[model samples]
Target: MDHFLGIFVVANCYRNGIGVVRSLQNANYWYQKERDKQLVATRELPYNVDNGLKNMLLENKYRLSWIPYNEFKNIEKIGEGGFATVYYAVWDNKYLDADIPAALKIIHRSKKYSEKDYSEQFIKELKAYCDIGYDNPSFLECYGVTMDDVSKEYIIVMRHALEGCLRKNLSSVAMMGWQNKLTLLLCIISDLKTIHSKKYYSSRFT
Candidate 1:
Protein backbone atom coordinates (compact mmCIF):
# COMPACT_ATOMS: atom_id res chain seq x y z
CA MET A 1 0.00 0.00 0.00
CA ASP A 2 2.92 2.43 0.82
CA HIS A 3 4.52 1.71 -2.58
CA PHE A 4 1.22 2.45 -4.40
CA LEU A 5 0.71 5.71 -2.48
CA GLY A 6 4.26 6.90 -3.38
CA ILE A 7 3.59 6.14 -7.08
CA PHE A 8 0.31 8.19 -7.00
CA VAL A 9 2.10 11.15 -5.42
CA VAL A 10 4.76 11.12 -8.20
CA ALA A 11 2.04 11.10 -10.87
CA ASN A 12 0.30 14.13 -9.33
CA CYS A 13 3.62 16.09 -9.28
CA TYR A 14 4.19 15.35 -12.99
CA ARG A 15 0.71 16.64 -13.92
CA ASN A 16 1.28 19.89 -12.00
CA GLY A 17 4.59 20.42 -13.81
CA ILE A 18 2.86 20.10 -17.19
CA GLY A 19 0.19 22.64 -16.18
CA VAL A 20 2.86 25.22 -15.17
CA VAL A 21 4.70 24.76 -18.49
CA ARG A 22 1.52 25.40 -20.49
CA SER A 23 0.74 28.53 -18.45
CA LEU A 24 4.22 29.94 -19.05
CA GLN A 25 3.93 29.40 -22.82
CA ASN A 26 0.59 31.25 -22.95
CA ALA A 27 2.05 34.17 -20.97
CA ASN A 28 5.07 34.53 -23.30
CA TYR A 29 2.85 34.53 -26.41
CA TRP A 30 0.61 37.27 -25.01
CA TYR A 31 3.65 39.37 -24.01
CA GLN A 32 5.06 39.15 -27.53
CA LYS A 33 1.72 40.17 -29.07
CA GLU A 34 1.47 43.19 -26.75
CA ARG A 35 4.99 44.30 -27.65
CA ASP A 36 4.22 44.20 -31.38
CA LYS A 37 1.03 46.21 -30.88
CA GLN A 38 2.96 48.88 -28.93
CA LEU A 39 5.55 49.24 -31.68
CA VAL A 40 2.88 49.74 -34.36
CA ALA A 41 1.11 52.37 -32.24
CA THR A 42 4.36 54.29 -31.71
CA ARG A 43 5.03 54.37 -35.46
CA GLU A 44 1.58 55.74 -36.21
CA LEU A 45 1.73 58.54 -33.61
CA PRO A 46 2.32 62.20 -34.68
CA TYR A 47 5.84 63.54 -34.62
CA ASN A 48 7.12 65.58 -31.69
CA VAL A 49 6.86 69.40 -31.82
CA ASP A 50 10.44 70.05 -32.99
CA ASN A 51 10.32 67.50 -35.79
CA GLY A 52 6.97 68.79 -36.91
CA LEU A 53 8.38 72.32 -37.30
CA LYS A 54 11.24 71.09 -39.45
CA ASN A 55 8.92 69.08 -41.67
CA MET A 56 6.61 72.04 -42.11
CA LEU A 57 9.45 74.27 -43.30
CA LEU A 58 10.90 71.67 -45.64
CA GLU A 59 7.53 70.77 -47.13
CA ASN A 60 6.75 74.44 -47.71
CA LYS A 61 10.01 74.76 -49.68
CA TYR A 62 11.78 76.73 -46.90
CA ARG A 63 9.42 79.64 -47.18
CA LEU A 64 9.66 81.42 -43.79
CA SER A 65 6.60 83.64 -44.13
CA TRP A 66 4.30 80.70 -44.54
CA ILE A 67 5.39 79.54 -41.09
CA PRO A 68 3.31 81.04 -38.32
CA TYR A 69 5.89 82.56 -35.99
CA ASN A 70 3.35 82.84 -33.19
CA GLU A 71 2.75 79.12 -33.42
CA PHE A 72 6.46 78.38 -33.06
CA LYS A 73 6.62 80.19 -29.68
CA ASN A 74 10.18 81.25 -28.94
CA ILE A 75 12.09 79.08 -26.49
CA GLU A 76 14.97 81.43 -25.83
CA LYS A 77 17.22 84.10 -27.29
CA ILE A 78 20.12 82.29 -28.94
CA GLY A 79 22.34 85.17 -29.99
CA GLU A 80 22.47 88.84 -30.74
CA GLY A 81 24.58 90.54 -33.42
CA GLY A 82 25.09 93.99 -34.89
CA PHE A 83 22.01 93.92 -37.13
CA ALA A 84 19.63 91.57 -35.41
CA THR A 85 18.83 89.22 -32.51
CA VAL A 86 18.37 85.47 -33.10
CA TYR A 87 15.85 83.49 -31.12
CA TYR A 88 15.37 79.72 -30.95
CA ALA A 89 11.86 78.67 -31.97
CA VAL A 90 9.91 75.38 -31.95
CA TRP A 91 6.81 74.52 -34.01
CA ASP A 92 4.58 71.71 -35.29
CA ASN A 93 5.17 69.99 -38.68
CA LYS A 94 1.88 68.28 -39.49
CA TYR A 95 2.18 69.38 -43.11
CA LEU A 96 5.19 67.18 -43.80
CA ASP A 97 4.81 63.52 -44.80
CA ALA A 98 7.95 62.37 -42.95
CA ASP A 99 7.51 64.83 -40.06
CA ILE A 100 11.11 66.00 -39.77
CA PRO A 101 12.51 67.97 -36.81
CA ALA A 102 13.22 71.70 -37.30
CA ALA A 103 14.46 74.90 -35.68
CA LEU A 104 14.27 78.58 -36.72
CA LYS A 105 16.52 81.55 -36.13
CA ILE A 106 14.15 84.46 -35.61
CA ILE A 107 15.80 87.70 -36.84
CA HIS A 108 14.58 90.74 -34.99
CA ARG A 109 14.23 94.09 -36.77
CA SER A 110 16.92 96.70 -36.19
CA LYS A 111 15.72 99.44 -33.89
CA LYS A 112 18.24 101.99 -35.19
CA TYR A 113 16.92 102.13 -38.73
CA SER A 114 14.13 104.35 -40.04
CA GLU A 115 11.33 102.66 -41.96
CA LYS A 116 12.78 103.68 -45.36
CA ASP A 117 16.35 102.73 -44.42
CA TYR A 118 15.15 99.44 -42.95
CA SER A 119 13.47 98.57 -46.21
CA GLU A 120 16.53 99.45 -48.27
CA GLN A 121 18.98 97.65 -45.99
CA PHE A 122 16.73 94.62 -45.74
CA ILE A 123 16.59 94.34 -49.52
CA LYS A 124 20.34 94.80 -49.78
CA GLU A 125 21.00 92.06 -47.25
CA LEU A 126 18.51 89.73 -48.93
CA LYS A 127 20.16 90.33 -52.29
CA ALA A 128 23.62 89.66 -50.85
CA TYR A 129 22.49 86.34 -49.34
CA CYS A 130 20.69 85.30 -52.50
CA ASP A 131 23.67 86.16 -54.72
CA ILE A 132 26.07 84.31 -52.44
CA GLY A 133 23.97 81.15 -52.83
CA TYR A 134 23.67 78.29 -50.31
CA ASP A 135 26.60 76.22 -51.56
CA ASN A 136 28.45 76.18 -48.24
CA PRO A 137 26.92 74.40 -45.28
CA SER A 138 29.18 76.46 -42.99
CA PHE A 139 27.38 79.51 -44.22
CA LEU A 140 24.04 80.09 -42.44
CA GLU A 141 21.14 78.49 -44.30
CA CYS A 142 18.52 81.13 -45.13
CA TYR A 143 15.12 79.53 -45.52
CA GLY A 144 12.65 82.41 -45.81
CA VAL A 145 12.42 86.24 -45.87
CA THR A 146 9.53 88.42 -44.82
CA MET A 147 8.73 92.01 -43.82
CA ASP A 148 6.13 92.85 -41.20
CA ASP A 149 3.47 95.19 -42.57
CA VAL A 150 3.02 97.04 -39.30
CA SER A 151 6.64 97.35 -38.18
CA LYS A 152 8.11 97.54 -41.71
CA GLU A 153 10.79 95.26 -40.34
CA TYR A 154 12.57 92.39 -42.06
CA ILE A 155 12.81 88.89 -40.66
CA ILE A 156 15.09 86.23 -42.08
CA VAL A 157 14.28 82.59 -41.36
CA MET A 158 17.32 80.37 -40.94
CA ARG A 159 18.22 76.88 -39.73
CA HIS A 160 19.06 76.72 -36.01
CA ALA A 161 22.49 75.51 -34.83
CA LEU A 162 22.41 73.80 -31.46
CA GLU A 163 26.21 73.68 -31.15
CA GLY A 164 26.52 77.48 -31.08
CA CYS A 165 29.19 79.44 -33.01
CA LEU A 166 32.79 79.13 -34.26
CA ARG A 167 33.76 82.09 -32.07
CA LYS A 168 32.82 80.18 -28.92
CA ASN A 169 34.72 77.13 -30.15
CA LEU A 170 37.76 79.28 -30.86
CA SER A 171 37.78 80.48 -27.27
CA SER A 172 37.92 76.86 -26.17
CA VAL A 173 40.87 76.30 -28.50
CA ALA A 174 42.77 79.19 -26.86
CA MET A 175 43.07 77.12 -23.67
CA MET A 176 44.17 73.99 -25.54
CA GLY A 177 47.73 72.82 -26.35
CA TRP A 178 49.72 74.71 -28.99
CA GLN A 179 49.42 71.82 -31.48
CA ASN A 180 45.62 72.02 -31.43
CA LYS A 181 45.76 75.81 -31.83
CA LEU A 182 47.93 75.41 -34.90
CA THR A 183 45.53 72.90 -36.36
CA LEU A 184 42.56 75.23 -35.78
CA LEU A 185 44.40 78.12 -37.41
CA LEU A 186 45.08 75.96 -40.46
CA CYS A 187 41.38 75.08 -40.69
CA ILE A 188 40.42 78.76 -40.49
CA ILE A 189 42.84 79.56 -43.29
CA SER A 190 41.32 76.80 -45.40
CA ASP A 191 37.84 78.27 -44.88
CA LEU A 192 39.14 81.73 -45.80
CA LYS A 193 40.63 80.31 -48.99
CA THR A 194 37.24 78.87 -49.94
CA ILE A 195 35.50 82.17 -49.28
CA HIS A 196 38.07 84.06 -51.33
CA SER A 197 37.62 81.63 -54.20
CA LYS A 198 33.85 82.14 -54.14
CA LYS A 199 34.28 85.91 -54.15
CA TYR A 200 36.69 85.70 -57.09
CA TYR A 201 34.27 83.57 -59.08
CA SER A 202 31.39 85.91 -58.35
CA SER A 203 33.38 88.94 -59.45
CA ARG A 204 34.74 87.32 -62.61
CA PHE A 205 31.44 85.97 -63.97
CA THR A 206 28.30 87.29 -62.23
Candidate 2:
Protein backbone atom coordinates (compact mmCIF):
# COMPACT_ATOMS: atom_id res chain seq x y z
CA MET A 1 0.00 0.00 0.00
CA ASP A 2 2.85 2.40 0.86
CA HIS A 3 4.53 1.67 -2.45
CA PHE A 4 1.25 2.22 -4.31
CA LEU A 5 0.79 5.49 -2.42
CA GLY A 6 4.33 6.62 -3.29
CA ILE A 7 3.72 5.96 -6.99
CA PHE A 8 0.38 7.86 -6.85
CA VAL A 9 2.04 10.84 -5.18
CA VAL A 10 4.82 10.93 -7.76
CA ALA A 11 2.36 10.68 -10.63
CA ASN A 12 0.25 13.52 -9.15
CA CYS A 13 3.32 15.68 -8.63
CA TYR A 14 4.45 15.08 -12.20
CA ARG A 15 1.00 15.90 -13.64
CA ASN A 16 0.65 19.07 -11.55
CA GLY A 17 4.12 20.36 -12.56
CA ILE A 18 5.06 20.59 -8.91
CA GLY A 19 8.70 21.73 -8.44
CA VAL A 20 11.24 21.72 -11.26
CA VAL A 21 11.70 18.97 -13.85
CA ARG A 22 14.75 17.51 -12.08
CA SER A 23 12.82 17.10 -8.79
CA LEU A 24 10.02 15.28 -10.60
CA GLN A 25 12.58 13.01 -12.31
CA ASN A 26 14.06 12.02 -8.93
CA ALA A 27 10.58 11.33 -7.48
CA ASN A 28 9.64 9.23 -10.51
CA TYR A 29 12.84 7.18 -10.18
CA TRP A 30 12.17 6.45 -6.48
CA TYR A 31 8.52 5.69 -7.16
CA GLN A 32 9.43 3.20 -9.90
CA LYS A 33 11.83 1.38 -7.55
CA GLU A 34 9.09 1.11 -4.88
CA ARG A 35 6.56 -0.16 -7.45
CA ASP A 36 8.97 -2.91 -8.58
CA LYS A 37 9.39 -4.09 -4.96
CA GLN A 38 5.62 -4.18 -4.50
CA LEU A 39 5.17 -6.23 -7.67
CA VAL A 40 7.73 -8.80 -6.41
CA ALA A 41 5.93 -9.08 -3.00
CA THR A 42 2.48 -9.53 -4.58
CA ARG A 43 2.89 -13.29 -5.19
CA GLU A 44 4.48 -14.15 -1.79
CA LEU A 45 1.87 -12.74 0.61
CA PRO A 46 -1.88 -13.20 0.98
CA TYR A 47 -3.66 -9.82 0.79
CA ASN A 48 -5.09 -9.41 4.29
CA VAL A 49 -5.81 -5.80 5.24
CA ASP A 50 -6.22 -5.00 8.94
CA ASN A 51 -9.44 -3.52 10.28
CA GLY A 52 -7.48 -0.52 11.58
CA LEU A 53 -6.33 0.39 8.08
CA LYS A 54 -9.87 0.03 6.79
CA ASN A 55 -11.19 2.24 9.58
CA MET A 56 -8.54 4.90 8.86
CA LEU A 57 -9.47 4.93 5.19
CA LEU A 58 -13.15 5.31 6.16
CA GLU A 59 -12.34 8.21 8.50
CA ASN A 60 -10.36 9.97 5.76
CA LYS A 61 -13.29 9.56 3.36
CA TYR A 62 -15.65 11.04 5.94
CA ARG A 63 -13.28 13.98 6.52
CA LEU A 64 -13.13 14.72 2.82
CA SER A 65 -16.93 15.21 2.97
CA TRP A 66 -16.74 17.73 5.84
CA ILE A 67 -14.06 19.63 7.75
CA PRO A 68 -13.22 18.68 11.33
CA TYR A 69 -12.95 21.39 14.03
CA ASN A 70 -10.16 19.84 16.09
CA GLU A 71 -7.93 19.36 13.04
CA PHE A 72 -8.57 22.98 11.93
CA LYS A 73 -8.79 21.51 8.44
CA ASN A 74 -10.70 24.17 6.50
CA ILE A 75 -11.40 26.61 9.36
CA GLU A 76 -8.97 29.38 10.30
CA LYS A 77 -9.30 31.25 13.62
CA ILE A 78 -9.20 34.92 12.68
CA GLY A 79 -10.55 36.89 15.63
CA GLU A 80 -11.69 36.73 19.23
CA GLY A 81 -13.46 39.15 21.54
CA GLY A 82 -15.16 39.03 24.96
CA PHE A 83 -18.29 37.23 23.73
CA ALA A 84 -17.04 34.83 21.05
CA THR A 85 -14.23 33.27 19.03
CA VAL A 86 -14.41 33.77 15.28
CA TYR A 87 -13.28 31.27 12.64
CA TYR A 88 -13.05 31.59 8.89
CA ALA A 89 -14.53 28.27 7.71
CA VAL A 90 -15.57 26.85 4.39
CA TRP A 91 -19.38 27.08 4.28
CA ASP A 92 -20.70 23.71 3.16
CA ASN A 93 -24.32 24.91 3.28
CA LYS A 94 -25.09 21.33 4.34
CA TYR A 95 -23.86 20.21 0.92
CA LEU A 96 -20.85 17.96 0.79
CA ASP A 97 -19.77 19.36 -2.56
CA ALA A 98 -20.03 23.03 -1.62
CA ASP A 99 -16.65 24.67 -1.01
CA ILE A 100 -17.74 28.27 -0.35
CA PRO A 101 -16.18 29.81 2.75
CA ALA A 102 -17.82 31.76 5.60
CA ALA A 103 -17.07 33.19 9.02
CA LEU A 104 -18.23 31.13 12.01
CA LYS A 105 -18.57 32.72 15.44
CA ILE A 106 -18.68 30.36 18.39
CA ILE A 107 -20.36 31.83 21.48
CA HIS A 108 -19.62 29.95 24.64
CA ARG A 109 -22.64 29.20 26.87
CA SER A 110 -21.64 31.05 29.99
CA LYS A 111 -21.70 28.95 33.12
CA LYS A 112 -22.65 32.14 35.01
CA TYR A 113 -25.97 32.40 33.19
CA SER A 114 -29.05 30.25 33.60
CA GLU A 115 -30.39 28.19 30.68
CA LYS A 116 -33.25 30.65 30.19
CA ASP A 117 -30.86 33.60 30.08
CA TYR A 118 -28.64 31.83 27.61
CA SER A 119 -31.58 31.09 25.32
CA GLU A 120 -32.80 34.70 25.55
CA GLN A 121 -29.36 36.07 24.77
CA PHE A 122 -29.07 33.75 21.79
CA ILE A 123 -32.41 35.00 20.46
CA LYS A 124 -31.46 38.62 21.02
CA GLU A 125 -28.19 38.15 19.14
CA LEU A 126 -30.04 36.54 16.27
CA LYS A 127 -32.55 39.39 16.14
CA ALA A 128 -29.78 41.98 16.21
CA TYR A 129 -28.01 40.24 13.36
CA CYS A 130 -31.25 40.09 11.35
CA ASP A 131 -32.08 43.74 12.03
CA ILE A 132 -28.66 44.79 10.89
CA GLY A 133 -29.23 42.72 7.75
CA TYR A 134 -26.63 42.30 4.97
CA ASP A 135 -26.64 45.97 4.00
CA ASN A 136 -22.87 46.32 3.92
CA PRO A 137 -20.66 43.61 2.49
CA SER A 138 -18.19 44.51 5.23
CA PHE A 139 -20.78 43.60 7.86
CA LEU A 140 -20.74 39.97 8.90
CA GLU A 141 -23.80 37.94 7.95
CA CYS A 142 -25.24 35.29 10.28
CA TYR A 143 -25.48 32.04 8.37
CA GLY A 144 -26.68 29.52 10.99
CA VAL A 145 -26.33 28.07 14.49
CA THR A 146 -25.15 24.67 15.68
CA MET A 147 -24.78 22.81 18.96
CA ASP A 148 -22.02 20.54 20.15
CA ASP A 149 -23.36 17.06 20.84
CA VAL A 150 -21.34 16.17 23.94
CA SER A 151 -20.83 19.63 25.47
CA LYS A 152 -24.25 20.97 24.43
CA GLU A 153 -22.62 24.28 23.52
CA TYR A 154 -24.35 26.60 21.05
CA ILE A 155 -22.37 28.28 18.23
CA ILE A 156 -23.35 31.13 15.94
CA VAL A 157 -21.98 30.90 12.37
CA MET A 158 -21.54 33.83 10.00
CA ARG A 159 -19.99 34.90 6.71
CA HIS A 160 -16.18 34.82 6.60
CA ALA A 161 -14.36 38.07 5.82
CA LEU A 162 -11.58 37.81 3.28
CA GLU A 163 -10.09 41.09 4.55
CA GLY A 164 -10.44 40.33 8.29
CA CYS A 165 -11.57 42.65 11.17
CA LEU A 166 -11.55 46.46 11.48
CA ARG A 167 -9.64 46.44 14.78
CA LYS A 168 -6.75 44.51 13.28
CA ASN A 169 -6.72 46.65 10.12
CA LEU A 170 -6.47 49.82 12.22
CA SER A 171 -3.29 48.72 13.95
CA SER A 172 -1.06 50.14 11.19
CA VAL A 173 -2.98 53.32 10.42
CA ALA A 174 0.23 55.34 9.94
CA MET A 175 1.21 53.07 7.04
CA MET A 176 -2.18 53.51 5.35
CA GLY A 177 -2.62 56.34 2.82
CA TRP A 178 -5.50 58.88 3.01
CA GLN A 179 -7.78 57.05 0.52
CA ASN A 180 -7.53 53.76 2.44
CA LYS A 181 -8.27 55.47 5.76
CA LEU A 182 -11.29 57.20 4.24
CA THR A 183 -12.62 53.87 2.98
CA LEU A 184 -12.20 52.31 6.41
CA LEU A 185 -13.95 55.25 8.07
CA LEU A 186 -16.85 54.95 5.64
CA CYS A 187 -17.34 51.25 6.48
CA ILE A 188 -17.26 51.96 10.21
CA ILE A 189 -19.79 54.78 9.87
CA SER A 190 -22.07 52.66 7.72
CA ASP A 191 -22.09 49.88 10.31
CA LEU A 192 -22.78 52.33 13.16
CA LYS A 193 -25.62 53.98 11.22
CA THR A 194 -27.29 50.59 10.63
CA ILE A 195 -27.07 49.70 14.30
CA HIS A 196 -28.48 53.09 15.34
CA SER A 197 -31.39 52.77 12.92
CA LYS A 198 -32.23 49.34 14.27
CA LYS A 199 -32.06 50.58 17.87
CA TYR A 200 -34.44 53.44 17.12
CA TYR A 201 -36.91 51.26 15.23
CA SER A 202 -36.97 48.64 17.96
CA SER A 203 -37.43 51.29 20.65
CA ARG A 204 -40.37 52.90 18.85
CA PHE A 205 -42.08 49.55 18.30
CA THR A 206 -41.63 48.59 21.94
Candidate 3:
Protein backbone atom coordinates (compact mmCIF):
# COMPACT_ATOMS: atom_id res chain seq x y z
CA MET A 1 0.00 0.00 0.00
CA ASP A 2 3.01 2.33 0.05
CA HIS A 3 3.41 4.92 -2.72
CA PHE A 4 6.83 6.14 -3.76
CA LEU A 5 7.27 7.57 -7.23
CA GLY A 6 4.57 5.07 -8.19
CA ILE A 7 6.59 2.26 -6.62
CA PHE A 8 4.32 0.25 -4.38
CA VAL A 9 4.92 -2.65 -2.07
CA VAL A 10 3.71 -5.45 -4.25
CA ALA A 11 4.84 -7.85 -1.54
CA ASN A 12 7.07 -7.84 1.46
CA CYS A 13 10.72 -8.62 0.85
CA TYR A 14 12.73 -10.60 3.45
CA ARG A 15 9.59 -12.60 3.89
CA ASN A 16 8.99 -16.26 2.97
CA GLY A 17 10.67 -15.99 -0.40
CA ILE A 18 13.73 -14.36 1.12
CA GLY A 19 14.36 -17.28 3.58
CA VAL A 20 16.85 -15.08 5.40
CA VAL A 21 14.62 -13.96 8.23
CA ARG A 22 13.63 -17.43 9.37
CA SER A 23 17.09 -18.86 8.96
CA LEU A 24 18.52 -16.24 11.27
CA GLN A 25 16.01 -16.88 14.03
CA ASN A 26 16.95 -20.53 14.58
CA ALA A 27 17.35 -21.07 18.32
CA ASN A 28 20.80 -21.36 19.97
CA TYR A 29 22.12 -20.00 16.67
CA TRP A 30 24.95 -17.95 18.09
CA TYR A 31 25.88 -20.41 20.82
CA GLN A 32 26.05 -23.26 18.36
CA LYS A 33 28.00 -21.28 15.82
CA GLU A 34 31.37 -21.29 17.53
CA ARG A 35 32.37 -21.52 13.90
CA ASP A 36 32.78 -17.76 13.97
CA LYS A 37 34.85 -17.89 17.17
CA GLN A 38 37.42 -19.96 15.30
CA LEU A 39 37.86 -17.11 12.83
CA VAL A 40 39.47 -14.98 15.55
CA ALA A 41 42.51 -17.11 16.22
CA THR A 42 44.80 -14.25 17.04
CA ARG A 43 43.32 -10.79 17.69
CA GLU A 44 39.81 -10.07 18.78
CA LEU A 45 37.85 -8.80 15.82
CA PRO A 46 35.50 -5.89 16.31
CA TYR A 47 32.18 -7.18 17.56
CA ASN A 48 29.48 -7.35 14.91
CA VAL A 49 28.34 -4.15 13.18
CA ASP A 50 25.03 -4.30 15.03
CA ASN A 51 26.73 -3.97 18.42
CA GLY A 52 29.17 -1.34 17.14
CA LEU A 53 26.27 0.81 15.93
CA LYS A 54 24.32 0.39 19.15
CA ASN A 55 27.33 1.39 21.24
CA MET A 56 27.90 4.47 19.09
CA LEU A 57 24.25 5.38 19.42
CA LEU A 58 24.52 5.12 23.21
CA GLU A 59 27.65 7.29 23.34
CA ASN A 60 25.91 10.01 21.30
CA LYS A 61 28.91 10.14 18.98
CA TYR A 62 26.47 10.51 16.11
CA ARG A 63 22.73 10.59 15.96
CA LEU A 64 21.46 7.71 13.84
CA SER A 65 18.05 6.26 13.17
CA TRP A 66 17.55 2.61 14.18
CA ILE A 67 14.85 1.18 12.02
CA PRO A 68 13.69 -2.32 12.87
CA TYR A 69 13.80 -5.00 10.22
CA ASN A 70 10.02 -5.32 10.31
CA GLU A 71 9.60 -1.68 9.34
CA PHE A 72 10.93 -2.30 5.83
CA LYS A 73 8.92 -3.91 3.05
CA ASN A 74 9.03 -4.37 -0.70
CA ILE A 75 12.81 -4.34 -0.71
CA GLU A 76 14.00 -4.17 -4.30
CA LYS A 77 17.61 -4.77 -5.18
CA ILE A 78 18.73 -1.73 -7.13
CA GLY A 79 22.50 -1.99 -7.41
CA GLU A 80 25.57 -3.79 -6.14
CA GLY A 81 29.12 -2.82 -5.32
CA GLY A 82 32.31 -4.43 -4.06
CA PHE A 83 31.17 -3.91 -0.47
CA ALA A 84 27.42 -3.68 -0.42
CA THR A 85 24.25 -3.99 -2.42
CA VAL A 86 21.81 -1.09 -2.73
CA TYR A 87 18.10 -1.50 -2.37
CA TYR A 88 14.97 0.58 -2.74
CA ALA A 89 12.46 0.03 0.03
CA VAL A 90 9.40 1.42 1.73
CA TRP A 91 10.13 2.29 5.35
CA ASP A 92 7.21 2.62 7.70
CA ASN A 93 8.41 3.21 11.20
CA LYS A 94 6.97 4.79 14.33
CA TYR A 95 9.84 7.25 14.59
CA LEU A 96 9.29 8.63 11.11
CA ASP A 97 6.76 11.40 10.65
CA ALA A 98 5.35 9.39 7.77
CA ASP A 99 6.20 6.39 5.69
CA ILE A 100 8.71 7.40 3.05
CA PRO A 101 10.86 6.03 0.31
CA ALA A 102 14.40 5.16 1.33
CA ALA A 103 17.60 3.78 -0.10
CA LEU A 104 19.13 0.85 1.78
CA LYS A 105 22.87 0.29 1.57
CA ILE A 106 23.07 -3.33 2.73
CA ILE A 107 26.65 -4.11 3.58
CA HIS A 108 27.75 -7.54 2.46
CA ARG A 109 29.30 -9.79 5.10
CA SER A 110 31.87 -11.94 3.25
CA LYS A 111 33.67 -10.23 0.41
CA LYS A 112 36.76 -8.15 -0.17
CA TYR A 113 36.62 -7.09 3.47
CA SER A 114 36.37 -9.28 6.53
CA GLU A 115 33.52 -8.83 9.01
CA LYS A 116 35.61 -6.39 11.03
CA ASP A 117 36.67 -4.32 8.06
CA TYR A 118 33.14 -4.15 6.73
CA SER A 119 31.82 -3.09 10.11
CA GLU A 120 34.36 -0.31 10.38
CA GLN A 121 33.73 0.94 6.86
CA PHE A 122 29.97 0.81 7.41
CA ILE A 123 30.19 2.95 10.52
CA LYS A 124 32.68 5.30 8.88
CA GLU A 125 30.40 6.20 5.96
CA LEU A 126 27.41 6.68 8.24
CA LYS A 127 29.44 8.91 10.53
CA ALA A 128 30.52 11.04 7.58
CA TYR A 129 26.99 12.43 7.47
CA CYS A 130 27.49 13.78 10.96
CA ASP A 131 31.11 14.83 10.33
CA ILE A 132 29.99 16.98 7.38
CA GLY A 133 27.48 18.39 9.83
CA TYR A 134 23.87 17.54 9.04
CA ASP A 135 22.89 21.19 9.62
CA ASN A 136 24.46 21.98 6.27
CA PRO A 137 21.92 21.80 3.43
CA SER A 138 24.18 19.88 1.06
CA PHE A 139 24.76 16.78 3.18
CA LEU A 140 22.70 13.77 2.32
CA GLU A 141 20.36 12.96 5.20
CA CYS A 142 21.24 9.62 6.78
CA TYR A 143 18.03 8.30 8.26
CA GLY A 144 19.70 5.51 10.22
CA VAL A 145 20.58 1.81 10.51
CA THR A 146 18.59 -1.29 9.74
CA MET A 147 19.71 -4.87 10.22
CA ASP A 148 19.23 -7.85 7.95
CA ASP A 149 18.59 -10.66 10.42
CA VAL A 150 19.23 -13.47 8.00
CA SER A 151 22.69 -12.48 6.87
CA LYS A 152 23.45 -10.59 10.07
CA GLU A 153 24.48 -7.64 7.92
CA TYR A 154 23.81 -3.99 8.67
CA ILE A 155 21.76 -1.88 6.28
CA ILE A 156 21.96 1.90 6.15
CA VAL A 157 18.62 3.52 5.53
CA MET A 158 19.07 6.90 3.93
CA ARG A 159 16.97 9.49 2.17
CA HIS A 160 16.72 8.32 -1.40
CA ALA A 161 18.30 10.57 -4.03
CA LEU A 162 15.83 10.24 -6.87
CA GLU A 163 17.95 11.85 -9.61
CA GLY A 164 20.82 9.60 -8.59
CA CYS A 165 24.04 11.29 -7.45
CA LEU A 166 25.22 14.69 -8.72
CA ARG A 167 27.50 13.11 -11.31
CA LYS A 168 24.57 11.39 -12.96
CA ASN A 169 22.80 14.73 -13.37
CA LEU A 170 25.78 16.46 -14.99
CA SER A 171 24.51 16.18 -18.57
CA SER A 172 21.37 18.12 -17.70
CA VAL A 173 23.41 20.40 -15.46
CA ALA A 174 25.55 21.34 -18.46
CA MET A 175 22.42 22.58 -20.24
CA MET A 176 21.50 24.87 -17.40
CA GLY A 177 22.24 28.59 -17.51
CA TRP A 178 25.33 30.02 -15.91
CA GLN A 179 23.32 31.10 -12.91
CA ASN A 180 22.23 27.54 -12.15
CA LYS A 181 25.74 26.24 -12.68
CA LEU A 182 27.09 28.89 -10.33
CA THR A 183 24.54 27.91 -7.70
CA LEU A 184 25.52 24.28 -7.95
CA LEU A 185 29.18 25.21 -7.65
CA LEU A 186 28.43 27.28 -4.58
CA CYS A 187 26.62 24.41 -2.91
CA ILE A 188 29.56 22.11 -3.53
CA ILE A 189 32.02 24.74 -2.33
CA SER A 190 29.96 25.45 0.74
CA ASP A 191 29.94 21.75 1.64
CA LEU A 192 33.69 21.59 1.19
CA LYS A 193 34.06 24.56 3.46
CA THR A 194 31.98 22.83 6.09
CA ILE A 195 34.25 19.77 5.98
CA HIS A 196 37.37 21.90 6.06
CA SER A 197 35.98 23.92 8.93
CA LYS A 198 35.87 20.72 10.95
CA LYS A 199 39.55 20.12 10.05
CA TYR A 200 38.58 17.04 8.06
CA TYR A 201 40.11 16.18 4.74
CA SER A 202 39.78 13.31 2.31
CA SER A 203 41.66 12.21 -0.79
CA ARG A 204 38.84 9.92 -1.83
CA PHE A 205 37.96 9.94 -5.50
CA THR A 206 34.27 10.55 -6.32
lDDT of each: 0.42, 0.49, 0.58
Best by TM-score: 3
If both were scored by TM-score, which would come out higher, candidate 1 or candidate 3?
3
Model 3 Cα lDDT, one tens digit per residue, 1-206: 12322221111111112223422123123312221221111122234545776676656544565667777888898777767788988787553235677799987776667767877887887777666644442344466677787887888777676554676688888998885576556556766787788777755313
Clashes of each: 5, 3, 0
Better of 1 and 3 by lDDT: 3
Each model's TM-score?
Answer: 0.45, 0.52, 0.62
Question: Which has the greatest lDDT?
Answer: 3
- So what's the TM-score on candidate 3? 0.62
In model 2, which regions exceed 4 Å deviation?
Answer: 1-73, 94-96, 134-138, 171-176, 200-206
Q: Rank the candidates by lDDT, best first.
A: 3, 2, 1
Clashing pairs in 1: 51-100, 51-101, 52-92, 52-93, 54-102
